[model samples]
Target chain A: MQDVTITINGDIVTGTIDERTLLLDFIRDVAGKTGTHNGCLEARCGCCSVEVEGDIVKSCNVLALQVAGRSVTTIEGLSKERLRPVEHVTSQSLAGMYAPLEAMGADVNDLHPVQVAFHQCHALQCGFCTPGMVMVMKNYLEENPEPTRDDVRTAIAGNLCRCTGYQHIVDAGMMAAETMRSQPDNSRPAPARPAHDH
Target chain B: MRAFTYLTPSAPTEVVEMLDAHAPDARVIAGGQNLLLGMKDRSDSPAFLVSLGGVSELEGVRAADSGELVIGAATTYATLARMEFTGWHAEIASVCGNLADRPVRTMGTIGGAACAADPRYDIPALVTGVGASLEVLSAQGVRTIEPSDFFLEGGGTSLQPGDLLTAVRFPATEAFTTVVFEKFRQRVFDAALASTVLALRVGDGVIEDLRLTVGATTPRPTVCVTSTAGLIGQPVDAIEPVLVADAAAIEVLGPETSNDPPHLRYQRELIKSVTRRALIRATAIPRS
Candidate 1:
């Protein structure tokens, strides 16, 4: 087993992983954190995306050893019972996109605002693409809180959904942003993360 | 993917020994943004991987004593984005910061990107415009190479098996120039279909120095500075034709083998667009 130290959900977790283990696999099998799911091994699907040191990257595309000293933030950290409003928007984006409210096989209930908007707009029919959609929305919104129509389309362009034509997905993003504005806390940072030293 | 031995060296020199010892069978992983992705798909896997992250000397950016900006091979795009500025700093920073997204750039390194020499990558052209050179260390010792000579005609560099790119340095000058980068990609970060970067030094309604580098259109990024030999003191208006002539010169150097004829046509257009705009932007800036 190879020793690897990676910060997960604001707290650094050290573990021993197989030599060829992937970051997503370690995060799921050994780390016991199921927020990032493994769908397609290729990065074509965005279900494996997680925030690593403030940057949202596809966890599946990286090896666990690569992140040996880096920090990663998964959806598991954003607890509905213990998160701020922006966290709420994030959870809403995830929950709104699917039926059981999960993506990449990781399940969660605290909906990101974008998720809620997706649901309100009836964005998905099969729900296979919601989690990826939610993740994309969360990152896009973080970069551009108020995105244009082109921005919204470009954000979701990589996500393939045969169920819905994607008009609802676009509407959902704007709607989530609008709805979250009604709640003042959504503009705030997720929460005071537990200090994790580099 | 097949399991393999992983080695993280603490020094750049050690990195060379490791790559050489393993030779042809081991992969030097910097950033791992592309290499890891390829491994994940089982497309290619080296028997061993030499992670360069532990080589601290290859991870920072600073201005050299000679006024050249030096970028370590392992310097991440995120770090380069945050690097302190000098004379044409904003243009370089803006282009790099705007690359891929916050995520990919966070792990992508300038050396890796430059060495990978992916046609879509902007650093090749960015550095070429600035007249940058790279510090490469092998078992033989260290050798510095200009951007023009570093990139080969196959979408990658001419890096020998054990040659580790140490840093990239550019001659610092107060020439306030005009530079513009334009790219056409299928998606936000899905590699480039065509991209171009043009940088020019202008003054007193006359052209001083200009560098136009086009990526994706050719196997490796190529600089069209042939006409720069003639534009030393030519008027700004007269420089456009010279720049066009330079672009034509580039089109004739290396045959486009990475793609078919139709695709080459699109890339040629991008080279033209960026060449034209770069000239316009440089003219707009006040001469220093």
Candidate 2:
């Protein structure tokens, strides 16, 4: 066993995991953050994506011990702190890049622009791949804030959804881009580190 | 996966010592992108995994004083893609950027990719195509292997059990040369069904020097040295499709030695087309 202390979802957690333990298993089983799902352990499905050191990586392809002393953000960490007081002024407290989603009330309130667009555009069928898709778009839009339909298609190519046929997802991403760019600078939360989850 | 002891050695010497101690039972894991999958599948059951995470020295890309480009073996593809390369190196960056998906690029290292030597991979062809040499270190000492000799006939490299690949060095490309990598895959992120790296040089209006490497469809990346020599002195636009087809057929695909004649024929045809397209695209724009 190797000792690993990692920062996950703004909390520091330490665990002694087997050398063979994958980061995806560590996040789900040891850290008890099951928001990062595992679709294909072989790193193809992109369901096990997470942010480590400001880049999104397939956690299943990474060893748990490799991320020792690093900060990892799973899907659970991608939202603003609901536990904090409503008027909490810490703008940077959110460990993820989904501020636009939170501002539009994607969680526990009104749907985020991406969520609303997905709902309106009918981007999902089973919703198993929704978390991964949202995570990819959140980071992709930050890099290419004004993406065309082709750009949106290329950005979400890694995250596969069998049911939706991808046309609706592309439409939803394009809609979210317009929604994100049109918002005022202050209305949008500060840009978080670009996530590279799958 | 079977449980094993994982050691993170800080220095390259320490890595060699650990490897010497473990020898045949040990595996040096840089990124674990491919190794982890192999371990999970029980294909590679190493008793000891020497993780090189703490070895910071083996992680960067630099232009040496001698005008040679030196890239640390452990440098991740994401980092390499972000580098400002000139001439031939830019071709390398383009290929590295296209390897797998964005996340996989973050974790996968050039050294790991080169060492794995999987025929379907892109890096081996890129390095060998650029005429780069690998720097390897072991308990005994350090030595450089030329690109032509570095990759073995089958998968994997000439690296010994205790050896750690330190870096790869490429001599500076001439000003007249421009390199381009072309790959045809089923998807944007999938491994190449057929790939080629072409480093073409034009003098006046004629082809000066050409280095072509055909990958993915071959058992190893085939550098068409003699075949490329045949193209020299011919005008870039005057180079016919028949020349490329004949070269790929004779040099890259040995028609008589193929076990599966039909598949070999299809691959030869694919190689011919990919090589031609890569050459055209590479020559279309002259490097400044």
Best by DockQ: 2
Maximum-lDDT candidate: 2
**Clashes by residue pair, model 2:** A55-A196, A56-A196, A56-A197, A106-A112
DockQ of candidate 1 compared with the true complex:
0.36
What range of 10 consecutive residues in model 1 chain A has the weakest lDDT sum?
A189-198
Lowest-sum lDDT 10-residue window in model 2 chain B: B252-261
Candidate 2 local lDDT, residue A79: 50
Clashes of 1: 16
Q: After superposition, how far is residue B58 of candidate 2 from its true place, in Å?
A: 1.3
Residue B249's lDDT within candidate 1 is 40
Estimated TM-score for each candidate: 0.80, 0.88
